[model samples]
Target: MKAAPAAQQELLRLQALDTRLAQLAHRLNALPQTAPLAELATRDDAVRRSRAEAVGVLEDAKTELGRIESDVRIVEARIARDGERLTQTSSLKDVQALEGELVSLKRRLSDLEDQELVVMEKVEGAEGAVAAIDDERAAIAVAQQSLEAERDEASAGIATEREQTDRDRAVVAATIPADLLAFYEQRRVRGGGVGAALLRQRTCGGCTITLTGSDLEAVRRAAPDDVVQCPECDRILVRTDESGI
Candidate 1:
């Protein structure tokens, strides 16, 4: 393929734009927040499970406390009724029977009150467990929010750079001959995003292999306007004063 020397050099500019675009894409995917965000997600899942277990414990403790409270109320009510009967009864036997029942009911109330105290402590402990889990969850949320913000800011900057680089690439590509540009585009796909490279100091810049013997002679015999490819990596070789051919 034949292209003006100036037009061939334009490939170097086009290649630079394409390389910058590729780097920006890679930066977007591998942002510093990406790994940390994934780790935060995993920690969040564990926290969610812990919170669920803590809530279940809290509910059980509350249910036990409720039962103890109800029992204490019933015993207190019985003691109050027996004390009233003892005061109102005129018969000694009735008074004695009411007194005995009052004593029993009071003892039962004391036992129920003790149980209530123990269960209340358990309820407090359960509540603390739930609260601790909540604090951890909140901390994770804050971290995730920060990371997301960082990712967004970094991604936005990379996106802007890529957009501008794309525009520059379009302009550079437009200055090349149609056939040459087409060939370069094909080479880019085949050469890992590098369509053209400067053959500096007898080295094929695309593959870093120094041309020798037959390969060196071929490039030397080619006209300045004749487009050439690096035999090693199949990329268009853009020659300049530093080519050392």
Candidate 2:
């Protein structure tokens, strides 16, 4: 598992790139528009419900108004027939009965007209409620579109950065030995994305643990080409003059 000092240094560069790439991915996922987009989704649901309720109300009002109008037509037709009969009637008793019926029919008409007016008012109000809900939904839709555009724009920029970082990683990884690179990848997955660390000042950079007498002695005695592992974190120890033996 030995690699040249230069190759080990390349691993450090790779680690830096990996860290930056991870950060970029995190930033892409946690864009500022994400929260607002979520909020917009919730608001859209509420607006849809309100619009449905308003439509129901409007339909009911229209049906009621239609029924009232139908009743008014029937009553008006009856009144016209009775008025004609009154003019043609001959017997005094028949004429008196006809007049009485006419008076009752007119009162009925007045009551029906009043009910119709009330229903018409309800229809108007219901229509207005529906329109208001529609307007609110439209505004929300516009806002959502704007937020989505912003999110996409931010994502595009991050995507470009990630592309460049990935290219750099590929180039750096290519320079390392195949077996070493594969081993590094394995360790990186198991060790939280870090496979190699500098043994700086006798401390394992991976775990920040300073090697003691026996462990430190072993590392100091190891050949320059020997791959040293951090006893604390099990990561490859990249030795340098700054390692302080």
TM-score of each: 0.70, 0.78
Candidate 2 lDDT, tens digit per residue, 105-200? 899999999999998999999999999999998999999999999999989999999999999999999999887788788878888988888889
Tell me the whole-model lDDT of each prediction, alpha carbons only.
Answer: 0.91, 0.89
Best by TM-score: 2
Q: After superposition, how far is residue 153 of candidate 2 from its true place, in Å?
A: 3.8
Residue 122, candidate 2: Cα error in Å is 2.2
Model 1, residue 49: distance off in Å is 3.3
Q: For model 1, what is the C-alpha lDDT against the true structure?
A: 0.91
Q: Where does the lowest 10-residue lDDT sum fall in candidate 1? A: 80-89
- What is candidate 2's CA lDDT for residue 119? 89
